[model samples]
Target: MRIVEAIGIGVLILLAALALLFLRRMVITRRGGTIELGVRLSTMVPGRGWSAGLARFAGDDLRWYRIFSFWPGPRRVLSRRGLAVDRRRAPDAAERLVLPPDWVIVRCVTRRSPVEIAMAERALTGFLSWVEAAPPGESTPDTRPYRYRAG
Candidate 1:
């Protein structure tokens, strides 16, 4: 019985060590701040009970996205210039989003404002509209001058 107990303790220690290593890896990646797009949202399960949707504008590409295990409510969105927040109501107030497998989160390393978010949403919608209406091989003009960068 004593020997069995000792083996169990050893296994528990090994599991704890592995868990620590995994956490460390995640921290290192976050610190790197080197993602393909400057604007990439790092989302987690919002809370015990909540769901929200996320959308990103890749210069006219309106990629409707979502996040899960995230929190909602009056949260500040950050950007390069500073905070351009919006007093959200209901759907707008959704800070934490529960995204589906098909959707993804595209957030900036920096904070953002409601205006910026609106702009991104608009641009993406417009771009999508144009793409649907345009000729098969034609490309739409990349009118978006601002680059979404997360700090």
Candidate 2:
């Protein structure tokens, strides 16, 4: 009877944790425009270490939140300043296994570090436009004019 009680308690705790995660995601999506994006901290390996997450654009900054995380805040906040696009490409054979077939891989270099973001072609187009867009009297020196058309 004691063992049964402990198992029941554990199940309840797990259910509550899942509910918390669901609520957190709802709040994040409601806060701003969210897009499905996968981020890799280091781009050293072409097809590894990618974490699936949702990203929100907030005042020239992109905030990333992991899909199944407990943290209420963004795990990474990538600012537009000092951001440069290294290159973009289609997923390799190995990457195809992990990433969606329609997604494009964009490698970017920020002031702090390098990151790889995998997203759909249309989404990438929008993201690039956001990066290239500049405010009045403000120029993006590190960022050069680059275009990616969905094909």
Number of the predicted model whose lDDT against the real structure is largest? 2
Tens digit of lDDT per residue, candidate 2, span 42-110?
557757888899999997889999998999999999887657777888888878898998999888877
Top of the candidates by TM-score:
2
- 104-147 per-residue lDDT for model 1 (tens digits): 22322223222222223324334324323434344323322233
| Each prediction's TM-score versus the true structure | 0.22, 0.88
Would you list the C-alpha lDDT of every candidate in the order shown?
0.33, 0.82
Angstrom error at residue 50, model 1: 46
C-alpha RMSD by candidate, in order: 14.1, 2.3
Candidate 1 TM-score over all chains jointly: 0.22
Span of ten consecutive residues with least summed lDDT in model 1: 83-92
Backbone clash total, candidate 2: 0
Clashing pairs in 2: none
**61, model 2: CA deviation in Å?**
0.4
lDDT of 1: 0.33
lDDT for position 84 in model 1: 20
